[model samples]
Target: MKKEVNIILAGSLGIILGIGLFGLRKFLKKKSQDYDDYYADFHRHFVKQAKDDGNDGIEFLAVQ
Candidate 1:
């Protein structure tokens, strides 16, 4: 019946959309974690370098 076909099509569309959204969320979460890790490593390296060179890190703010 026509009504049954419409219901089936709507159901399938909803399921596809849900799956797409879930996949996007997972991908973003992973990318965010990667970015955080990179920032931490960079900060550590910068601090170590500053200390080795006898500096206490940058306290002066840059003028915009």
Candidate 2:
């Protein structure tokens, strides 16, 4: 009886840990995708602004 109880407890613990890991992976992947989308939008705007202003984007890189 005692061995059976231990096995049950271990199994439950393993299941909980697995679920937590899976959730964490999903959350990180979503956050990573959000970051990539933000960067792409920023790049698009930066290039558009540079083109509209008639300046090569490299001038912004000069040390002040």
TM-score of each: 0.63, 0.63
lDDT of 2 at 22: 100
**Candidate 2 structure quality by residue, lDDT tens digits, 18-64:** 99999999999999999998887767744633236665477676843
lDDT of 1 by residue, 1-64 (tens): 9999999999999999999999999999999999998887767744634236554456633432
| Clash pairs (backbone) in predicted model 2 | none
Q: What are the Cα lDDT values of the candidates? A: 0.83, 0.86
Q: How many residue pairs clash in each candidate?
A: 0, 0
* CA lDDT for candidate 1: 0.83
Error of 2 at 40 (Å): 1.5
